[model samples]
Target: MNLTIQFYTMLSMIGMGAWVGAALDTYHRFLQRPRRKRWIVFLHDIFFWTVQALIVFYVLLRVNEAELRFYVFIALLCGFAAYQSLLKKLYTACLEAIIQFCVRTYQFFAMLIRNLLIKPIIYLAQALLALFLFLLHMLKIIFLGIYKVLFKLLWMLWKLLFIPLGFLGHLLWKLVPQRAKIFIARYAGFLKQITKVKGIILKWWNAIRTRLGGPRE
Candidate 1:
């Protein structure tokens, strides 16, 4: 279990790295002025080049085979180049997957909240109104218990419906046409928008918590 947790943590870290990598690509591509390119190049040389040198040094210290180390270094450099060239595309695909996951999860949670909170509120209001009407001699409380049972039954039915609907949403995405895939390829922008929204929410929540004692005991 500990190993499994560590593995998952590593994956999460890699996902974060990929996210940062994508953001970096986006920033450099669109935001960098032509005159600032020299500064950016200098920064990249000072940072990533140093990292590359360290990787080489580490490989040389650990490897017994010189040819193997050379090959590894070549592969590493090639991978870095590929990563730079394809970072936008890779990030876009990752974001698309994330968006799909978020949408489905949101739908599931919305259904749950509607059933648990909203439905109960509506039912309570209706029950109160019915009770008032009955007291006025226009109705009876004979079916109050039956209405209670129906509320419970309706919630259960909705839970079942949304669960299957969420699954179907996932399934439908898998059946998209190849032509539409080209249009969907701009998913990194979608991810960026979502991340911006998340950042705003985080900031708002943090400020509220800092001001108030937050959740009551």
Candidate 2:
């Protein structure tokens, strides 16, 4: 818990520092006069960078070797300060203000993206959900269509043929004993005949189709 709190505090500090740094950069670049106070802006930049660097250094020290890290931190701070001032010369006097404005603009967009992109990760997970639902609905419709056609075919068969077969089966079942060895024998023979007839018909159909240049069964 202590570590969690420390980490949160550190994160908050970094966020606040970034906000301040960006604002300062914007102010110095655009709103403030460039010729008026070069020394002041330089000093302000140094101070803010130093505070930020110190915070960073402190955070690192808590997790790193102290002596070597402190030296590195100092060197980094010096480099950071130098870079901040050097930007004025590097980007050219005319473009310095524009560059500063661009930095602030980038920061704004970055913050915007961070907030906007992560919020709906779970809720908006399926941008494809609607497509999935549509596909499911289409599949259901297709299945139902096929089912209705099949049911109609079966209904016709029952009316024309299966009803009679059912009646015949019922009569046989009633006349035959509930436990009949002969019933099993007859049933097996009937199945074998049906299979043999089907195979013969299929072979004949294939032969006919082949002669007619149609697909084989």
Candidate 3:
């Protein structure tokens, strides 16, 4: 190659070497190999080296038409050595600062979204639920009040009819013959005895069912 082409290739190789060093540092910083499983670290290392090789080859192709020479390798090594000695610390610090800033920004946005959107939606749902429950409570009270008022009115009407019927019954009793009155009394007594017997039988049945571990109803 001409001297001009050689110089350009040398410069490109040096720059590429420095870039590779920086990329390696960045990869290690993010990868945190010590925290990863051995197999996982192995896989990541393989991938990183493969990608770096491909990038280096691509840059070499761009600068020197894919030429391979001893001086190119020497220039690359010098550049990498220089970066390790002079730039590693500064680059690592800047990388860490940038990563921290990104993390903080994400956290801030998440907090803002939660406060502005999610919290209001949650509060609105709670308020709607409370309003629904309150309306249901009010409806129950209103219905109960109506039921009580209707029941009281019916009770009063029944009382008014009952009083007149009781007076009519007494007059009818006075007009009834003595034999018919005796018959009615005997029938009522028989009915009362039948009811007592029925109640006694039901009690016995319930007791038997309870002993058998069955429901009485």
Every candidate's lDDT: 0.62, 0.62, 0.89
**What is the TM-score of candidate 3?**
0.79
Q: Pick the candidate with the highest lDDT.
A: 3
TM-score per candidate: 0.29, 0.26, 0.79
lDDT by residue (1-217, candidate 2, tens digit) is: 2566544444444444443444456556654656657788778778767876676557545544233423443444444454455543554454676777989999999888877886566457676687789999999999977976675566467568957897998898778875684667669978899989989988986675465444564
Instruction: Summarize candidate 3's per-residue lDDT along 121-195 as a digit string, tens digits.
Output: 999999999999999999999997797667557656866997999899999999999999888887997889998
lDDT of 1 by residue, 27-92 (tens): 455444565677877786577546645554444344432233234444544545555676767666
Worst 10 residues of 1 by lDDT: 61-70
RMSD of each: 41.3, 21.0, 7.4
Off by over 4 Å in 1: 1-20, 25-81, 137-217
Supply candidate 3's per-residue lDDT for 159. 69
Better candidate number, 1 or 3, judged by lDDT = 3
Model 2 clashing-pair count:
0
Q: RMSD in Å for candidate 1, one decimal?
A: 41.3
